[model samples]
Target: MHLSLGFSPCPNDTFIFDAMVNNKIDTKGLTFDTQLEDVETLNRWALEGKLPITKLSFAVYLKVKEQYDLLNSGSALGRGCGPLLIAKRDIPRDEIKDLTIAIPGENTTANLLFSIAFPEAKKKKIMVFSDIENAVLNGEADAGVIIHENRFTYQLKGLVKLMDMGEFWEETTGSPIPLGGIFIRKDVPADVRAKVDTLIHESLQHAYRHYPQLSDYVKSHAQEMDEQVMRQHIDLYVNDFSLDLGTEGKAAVTSLMEAAQKLRN
Candidate 1:
């Protein structure tokens, strides 16, 4: 069976999901979509029951939480896995009020977290991850909500790391960043969904058991991706955080959402 697996170009997920499909361990194949536009695209398909499997960030999942049943809380942008809200380090975290902040995209978890932490901060629109560096350096925004490769590469860009949302959340509320997840469309056969979920968990076990080979795994997925950057990317988002959200990750999400509510003007 061809599993329509929709995902963003998140490094760890692209590699792990692809490896499982490539080896043809159980499923016949996959139709992989890496578009970073919005979860609405995937959610629309999911609402129509077009997928057997898909990934949705918590913010996205919130939009259709009842439409899909979670197979597992997975592929998280774990603790220390996401980018920092950098702003020349000398800038105090609480003093961010009235400052402009660059967000990689609208309606994203980064923005969600930004809403939670820096409600008074203004937003600057930038599409790609790396561009957040340029936006901040050029004073496009006092800070930026970054993700993906930029999380590991920003020090080279001279942005002072103000705070990693992941770190901040852990210290304050303690939870993994619920960045991404896998779920089954509500109407999919329970047995089929269970089988796929089992495969994913099993494959994850295999992926971690041989984590030493992950660099090579990353190389194959990201053709132009540097091994060091890949390693850094893996380090940032994949951790015990992935094994399960555990108590901490759940608290992080709840506190973030509560914080977001308070921040809403």
Candidate 2:
């Protein structure tokens, strides 16, 4: 059976998915028609139930849990790897609420975490994650929340970190930040979902076996990203949690969902 899959083109994603999508691993008779998009686009598509399987921010998943079932594998959940709130110059934390900030997307985990950190910061500009650094530097936004490969490159661009959102989450909740996960539409057969989950796990294992060597697939879609930064992106986002959410991972996700709900209330 052919299933549609959607995930970001970031190095970590491309690295995890390259093996399965490239036919490097046996998909157990399942074939994937993949769509490579940014996380925000994937998040919006999830709202419409646009794919059989897709990667979306945990924030968006809470809004669509009824339409999809979270897969145990292929998740981007880990500690010390959270979105960074950055600015071109020093900005007092007390001043954050009054500044116009740039976010990658309203539905992104970065935006969700930012909301939790500063609920009073109501002025926000949504833009592609890659463009946020420039937005701050040009004074279009006083501060920006950045994720993905941007976390590795921001300081190089002379951006200063105002807060490490992941650190705040860990310090407060005592859990790893549940950034994003791969989910399958609930309508997909249970057996198929299970098979897809296993395939994803195996795919990552295959990538790990060849560890520290960047694949052409990962590098190709990384655009102009430096190879070193691309590796950092993978190291930070993909981990044991990517193979399986496990107990701690699931608890972290639950904590994130509960936090989001409290904000909604």
Best by TM-score: 2
Each model's RMSD to truth, in Å?
A: 3.6, 0.7
How do the predictions measure up, each by TM-score? 0.80, 0.99
Best by lDDT: 2
- Candidates' C-alpha lDDT: 0.63, 0.94
Q: Per-residue alpha-carbon lDDT of model 1 for 13-39, expressed as tens digits? A: 654564465563554343333333244
| Candidate 2 lDDT tens digits, 166-252 | 999999999999999999999999999999999999999999999899899999998798888898999999999999999999999
Please estimate how well model 2 matches the true structure, expressed as its whole-model Cα lDDT.
0.94
Query: 21 in model 2: Cα distance from truth in Å?
Result: 0.7
| Candidate 1 Cα RMSD after full superposition onto the native fold (Å) | 3.6
Model 1's alpha-carbon lDDT is 0.63
For candidate 1, list the clashing residue pairs, or say none.
Answer: 81-236, 81-237, 175-248, 175-249, 176-249
